[model samples]
Target: MGALMSVAPEPGWPEPEWHRPPVGGYTADDLDRLPNLPPHTELIDGSLILVSPQTAFHMRAMRLLENRLLEAAPPELDVAREMTVTLGPRDRPEPDVLVVKGEAEPRQTTFQPEDVILAIEVVSAESEARDRNVKPRKYAEAGIRHFWRVEEDKGLPVVYVFELEPATKTYVVSGIYHEQLKVPVPFPIKIDLTAINRRQP
Candidate 1:
């Protein structure tokens, strides 16, 4: 019993290496098999990235947008949140919101790129770069027809919508919207940004 007291508390946990890649780095399928992974873990360019905790604005905005999209979506389309799309062997990213074609299986955890018509990212301070640039490029490369990145401005959402240019396999800025997001592609969608995070009786 005395010996136990003699041991000092361990140093601040060293930089986590368990999520580090092996000889050739991680793969998309590895995400599904990895044990004890934090929820919403993403594989980006063969590196496992545990995303930052979402802000209150993020959660409310995401829910509001998802609900609105669901209301406006066509019968054949479905809206999902925080679901991964396996873009390639080295890339599987979970978007904040997705508009996917057809019905998903009960046990489906990942979707194929071809099935996703729109992937939306709600930008958080920590995820600005990835949300604005990295994700769009990958989504476009996989031929996803549309993408949206939402930014917070004084507690309101400002949406930037993009469309894939097949000739270059790149994304072209479709529009930047504030207050109201109205779009015609990938089926019509209109949202009132001010409604996000509003208190309801």
Candidate 2:
């Protein structure tokens, strides 16, 4: 007897069939099984939302911010980029940058809300509403203590910092920084946004 083999699709040809989620929607487990998902595909209330691709400016800002945070973070805390934070059974958001407690363990897939100390999102044209409004509410409700949003204005980075109100499960603006990002929570650190936003050669 010979072994059966599946035929591969020809170059430049689409697959004969594609897997689609059920009418109800895809669960977190279902999303986890799919491979080759576009970067920043998130599951929110069982609906998959594709976050827009990061612009070159966004990438540079994120890298610069991450490096600064990593430098100031205490040994008990760690910084990560584009890691999934599980908010609920159907909510898995990949924040642009995040600060978490302790070092990363091997094979860690997603972070629980409690495991995260701060979550940062850089607003993009496509995700402004979600980043500025929707995510803050959700992150607050999940009991994550701190949040920061970076907005690009006139080609410069503007940082907004927030802290959670435990009673209301909401975030209140702590500070807004234009050329500098300075904060006391999660350890005191300062970042020169102007320098970070400068074009790299």
Candidate 3:
């Protein structure tokens, strides 16, 4: 017996059966187990959400943030890009960038919400609503401490920072940055937004 995903699909090519959802859709645990799923596929409310092709801005910005975060992160924490955090039995959403407590294992694919300290989403035209509205709310509800939403402004990056309000299970805006992002929680950090100008990371 062999797994459906035993052999990797070529770039831009997914398994033909990838579009077919399970009888009840997919659950959080099914993401790694399902062979037909393309990389970066996410399960939201038990439905698989296929990722749209990446734009240059989206690609560059995400990588820049990931690199800057890895550099600024404390020794005890880890930073990963495009990794899913398991929020519940039926919910698993992949953030553009995430910071988690403790060291990363060799094959870990998901992080529990409690282990994620920060979840960052860079807004894309197709996912603006979910990035700005849905995902942050869910991250907060799961008790993740911090969230950041990055949006484009005149072709530059603008970052919005939020802190979880434990009492209400919601996020409250802590600050917004247009050029540089300097934050104290998660870790003391400073990022130069202009670095995304090169258009690739």
Q: Which stretches of candidate 1 lie over 4 Å from their true place?
A: 1-17, 199-201
lDDT by residue (tens digit), candidate 3, 152-200: 9887899999999889999999999988888898779999998886644
Backbone clashes, candidate 1: 0
Candidate 2 structure quality by residue, lDDT tens digits, 146-165: 99999988888889999999
Candidate 3 residue 19 Cα shift, in angstroms, is 3.5
Report the number of the highest-TM-score candidate.
Answer: 1
* Candidate 2 lDDT for residue 169: 95
Q: Give the TM-score of candidate 3.
A: 0.88
lDDT of 1 by residue, 16-119 (tens): 34445587778888887877666788888877777676789898888988899899999999999999999999988899999999989998999999999899
Task: Note the residue pairs that clash in candidate 3.
Answer: none
RMSD of each: 7.2, 7.4, 5.5
Q: Lowest-scoring 10 consecutive residues by lDDT in candidate 2? A: 1-10
Clashing residue pair totals per candidate (backbone < 3 A): 0, 0, 0
Q: Cα lDDT of model 2 overall?
A: 0.80
TM-score of each: 0.89, 0.87, 0.88
